[model samples]
Target: MIGFSDTSISKIAKRASVSAATIYIYHENNEDLLYKTYLKIKGKMSEKMFQGVDHTRTVYERFEAIIRNYVDFIQSFKDYFLFLEQIMNSPLPQKWC
Candidate 1:
Protein backbone atom coordinates (compact mmCIF):
# COMPACT_ATOMS: atom_id res chain seq x y z
CA MET A 1 0.00 0.00 0.00
CA ILE A 2 1.13 3.55 -0.66
CA GLY A 3 2.03 5.27 2.57
CA PHE A 4 0.11 8.39 3.63
CA SER A 5 3.17 10.58 3.05
CA ASP A 6 3.02 9.77 -0.67
CA THR A 7 -0.77 9.99 -0.95
CA SER A 8 -2.51 13.04 -2.42
CA ILE A 9 -6.09 14.26 -2.67
CA SER A 10 -6.26 13.60 -6.36
CA LYS A 11 -4.79 10.13 -5.99
CA ILE A 12 -7.29 9.27 -3.28
CA ALA A 13 -10.15 10.73 -5.23
CA LYS A 14 -9.13 8.82 -8.34
CA ARG A 15 -8.83 5.60 -6.38
CA ALA A 16 -12.26 6.26 -4.85
CA SER A 17 -13.69 7.02 -8.29
CA VAL A 18 -14.50 10.57 -7.34
CA SER A 19 -13.04 13.97 -8.12
CA ALA A 20 -10.80 15.89 -5.76
CA ALA A 21 -13.49 18.55 -5.40
CA THR A 22 -15.92 15.85 -4.38
CA ILE A 23 -13.64 14.90 -1.53
CA TYR A 24 -13.33 18.53 -0.53
CA ILE A 25 -17.10 18.78 -0.52
CA TYR A 26 -17.04 16.65 2.61
CA HIS A 27 -13.54 17.13 4.00
CA GLU A 28 -11.59 20.29 4.65
CA ASN A 29 -8.35 18.59 3.58
CA ASN A 30 -6.49 15.29 3.45
CA GLU A 31 -5.96 15.20 7.20
CA ASP A 32 -9.68 15.78 7.75
CA LEU A 33 -10.47 12.83 5.52
CA LEU A 34 -8.11 10.56 7.39
CA TYR A 35 -9.39 11.76 10.75
CA LYS A 36 -12.99 11.18 9.73
CA THR A 37 -12.13 7.69 8.50
CA TYR A 38 -10.43 6.95 11.80
CA LEU A 39 -13.53 8.04 13.70
CA LYS A 40 -15.80 5.95 11.53
CA ILE A 41 -13.68 2.81 11.89
CA LYS A 42 -13.30 3.36 15.62
CA GLY A 43 -17.07 3.64 15.98
CA LYS A 44 -17.55 0.39 14.10
CA MET A 45 -14.96 -1.39 16.24
CA SER A 46 -16.55 -0.07 19.43
CA GLU A 47 -19.97 -1.27 18.34
CA LYS A 48 -18.67 -4.72 17.48
CA MET A 49 -16.63 -4.91 20.68
CA PHE A 50 -19.77 -4.54 22.83
CA GLN A 51 -22.33 -6.32 20.71
CA GLY A 52 -24.45 -8.92 22.51
CA VAL A 53 -22.80 -8.16 25.83
CA ASP A 54 -25.37 -9.06 28.46
CA HIS A 55 -25.51 -6.81 31.44
CA THR A 56 -27.39 -9.45 33.45
CA ARG A 57 -24.46 -11.80 33.26
CA THR A 58 -21.78 -12.10 35.97
CA VAL A 59 -18.79 -9.77 35.81
CA TYR A 60 -16.53 -12.49 34.52
CA GLU A 61 -19.06 -13.49 31.87
CA ARG A 62 -19.47 -9.89 30.73
CA PHE A 63 -15.71 -9.44 30.49
CA GLU A 64 -15.35 -12.68 28.57
CA ALA A 65 -18.13 -11.71 26.21
CA ILE A 66 -16.46 -8.38 25.47
CA ILE A 67 -13.16 -10.11 24.80
CA ARG A 68 -14.81 -12.64 22.52
CA ASN A 69 -16.56 -9.90 20.64
CA TYR A 70 -13.28 -8.02 20.21
CA VAL A 71 -11.57 -11.16 18.93
CA ASP A 72 -14.41 -11.72 16.49
CA PHE A 73 -14.13 -8.14 15.24
CA ILE A 74 -10.38 -8.47 14.72
CA GLN A 75 -10.84 -11.75 12.87
CA SER A 76 -13.77 -10.64 10.74
CA PHE A 77 -12.58 -7.11 9.96
CA LYS A 78 -8.83 -7.45 9.90
CA ASP A 79 -8.37 -4.51 7.55
CA TYR A 80 -10.34 -2.16 9.74
CA PHE A 81 -8.45 -3.35 12.79
CA LEU A 82 -5.13 -2.82 11.08
CA PHE A 83 -6.20 0.63 9.94
CA LEU A 84 -7.05 1.54 13.50
CA GLU A 85 -3.64 0.33 14.67
CA GLN A 86 -1.91 2.44 12.05
CA ILE A 87 -3.93 5.55 12.89
CA MET A 88 -3.22 5.11 16.58
CA ASN A 89 0.50 5.48 15.90
CA SER A 90 -0.03 8.50 13.66
CA PRO A 91 -0.41 12.18 14.57
CA LEU A 92 -4.10 12.14 13.76
CA PRO A 93 -4.91 10.59 17.13
CA GLN A 94 -2.99 13.26 18.99
CA LYS A 95 -4.78 15.96 17.03
CA TRP A 96 -8.26 14.50 17.35
CA CYS A 97 -8.37 12.00 20.19
Candidate 2:
Protein backbone atom coordinates (compact mmCIF):
# COMPACT_ATOMS: atom_id res chain seq x y z
CA MET A 1 0.00 0.00 0.00
CA ILE A 2 1.18 3.50 -0.78
CA GLY A 3 1.60 6.01 1.97
CA PHE A 4 -0.74 8.99 1.95
CA SER A 5 2.04 11.24 0.70
CA ASP A 6 2.78 8.87 -2.17
CA THR A 7 -0.83 8.27 -3.19
CA SER A 8 -2.45 9.92 -6.18
CA ILE A 9 -5.90 10.05 -7.70
CA SER A 10 -4.89 7.67 -10.44
CA LYS A 11 -3.61 5.16 -7.92
CA ILE A 12 -6.82 5.40 -5.94
CA ALA A 13 -8.90 5.02 -9.10
CA LYS A 14 -6.93 2.01 -10.20
CA ARG A 15 -7.32 0.35 -6.82
CA ALA A 16 -11.03 1.01 -6.81
CA SER A 17 -11.29 -0.30 -10.39
CA VAL A 18 -12.48 3.07 -11.61
CA SER A 19 -11.06 5.68 -13.97
CA ALA A 20 -9.19 8.76 -12.82
CA ALA A 21 -11.88 10.87 -14.45
CA THR A 22 -14.47 9.12 -12.31
CA ILE A 23 -12.62 10.08 -9.17
CA TYR A 24 -12.43 13.67 -10.31
CA ILE A 25 -16.19 13.63 -10.78
CA TYR A 26 -16.58 13.03 -7.04
CA HIS A 27 -13.53 14.88 -5.64
CA GLU A 28 -12.24 18.21 -6.81
CA ASN A 29 -8.72 17.11 -5.93
CA ASN A 30 -6.74 14.71 -3.76
CA GLU A 31 -6.77 17.15 -0.85
CA ASP A 32 -10.54 17.30 -1.05
CA LEU A 33 -10.72 13.53 -1.10
CA LEU A 34 -8.48 13.26 1.93
CA TYR A 35 -10.50 15.88 3.76
CA LYS A 36 -13.75 14.07 3.05
CA THR A 37 -12.27 10.74 4.06
CA TYR A 38 -11.02 12.26 7.30
CA LEU A 39 -14.46 13.64 8.04
CA LYS A 40 -16.11 10.31 7.32
CA ILE A 41 -13.79 8.39 9.62
CA LYS A 42 -14.01 11.03 12.32
CA GLY A 43 -17.78 10.85 12.19
CA LYS A 44 -17.71 7.09 12.61
CA MET A 45 -15.23 7.36 15.47
CA SER A 46 -17.36 9.97 17.18
CA GLU A 47 -20.38 7.72 16.88
CA LYS A 48 -18.47 4.92 18.54
CA MET A 49 -17.17 7.20 21.26
CA PHE A 50 -20.67 8.25 22.21
CA GLN A 51 -22.39 4.93 21.77
CA GLY A 52 -24.48 3.93 24.81
CA VAL A 53 -23.10 6.73 26.93
CA ASP A 54 -25.78 8.35 29.06
CA HIS A 55 -25.84 12.12 28.82
CA THR A 56 -27.47 12.35 32.22
CA ARG A 57 -24.65 10.50 33.88
CA THR A 58 -21.97 12.20 35.94
CA VAL A 59 -19.17 13.92 34.04
CA TYR A 60 -16.64 11.43 35.33
CA GLU A 61 -18.77 8.51 34.29
CA ARG A 62 -19.37 9.96 30.85
CA PHE A 63 -15.67 10.64 30.40
CA GLU A 64 -14.78 7.13 31.45
CA ALA A 65 -17.37 5.59 29.17
CA ILE A 66 -16.18 7.70 26.27
CA ILE A 67 -12.58 6.62 26.88
CA ARG A 68 -13.64 2.98 26.93
CA ASN A 69 -15.57 3.47 23.73
CA TYR A 70 -12.53 5.15 22.15
CA VAL A 71 -10.38 2.14 23.04
CA ASP A 72 -12.93 -0.18 21.46
CA PHE A 73 -13.02 1.97 18.34
CA ILE A 74 -9.24 1.93 18.09
CA GLN A 75 -9.14 -1.84 18.44
CA SER A 76 -11.93 -2.43 15.94
CA PHE A 77 -10.72 0.10 13.39
CA LYS A 78 -6.98 0.25 13.77
CA ASP A 79 -6.36 1.38 10.23
CA TYR A 80 -8.94 4.12 10.49
CA PHE A 81 -7.59 5.12 13.88
CA LEU A 82 -4.07 5.36 12.47
CA PHE A 83 -5.30 7.28 9.47
CA LEU A 84 -6.98 9.76 11.74
CA GLU A 85 -3.82 10.14 13.79
CA GLN A 86 -1.74 10.70 10.70
CA ILE A 87 -4.15 13.27 9.32
CA MET A 88 -4.47 15.01 12.63
CA ASN A 89 -0.72 15.37 12.85
CA SER A 90 -0.40 16.66 9.30
CA PRO A 91 -0.72 20.23 8.00
CA LEU A 92 -4.04 19.28 6.39
CA PRO A 93 -5.64 19.28 9.83
CA GLN A 94 -5.49 23.08 9.81
CA LYS A 95 -8.21 22.99 7.17
CA TRP A 96 -10.45 21.02 9.51
CA CYS A 97 -10.64 23.82 12.06
Candidate 2 matches the true fold with a TM-score of 0.91
lDDT for every model? 0.89, 0.93
TM-score of 1: 0.93
lDDT of 1: 0.89
**Using TM-score as the measure, which candidate wins?**
1
TM-score of each: 0.93, 0.91
Highest-scoring model, lDDT? 2
Which residue pairs collide in model 1, if any?
none
**lDDT of candidate 1 over 4-94, digit per residue (tens):** 6678899999999999999999999888888888889989999998999999999999999999999999999999998888888777677
Name model 1 segments beyond 4 Å from true.
none
Instruction: Write down the lDDT that model 2 would get.
Output: 0.93
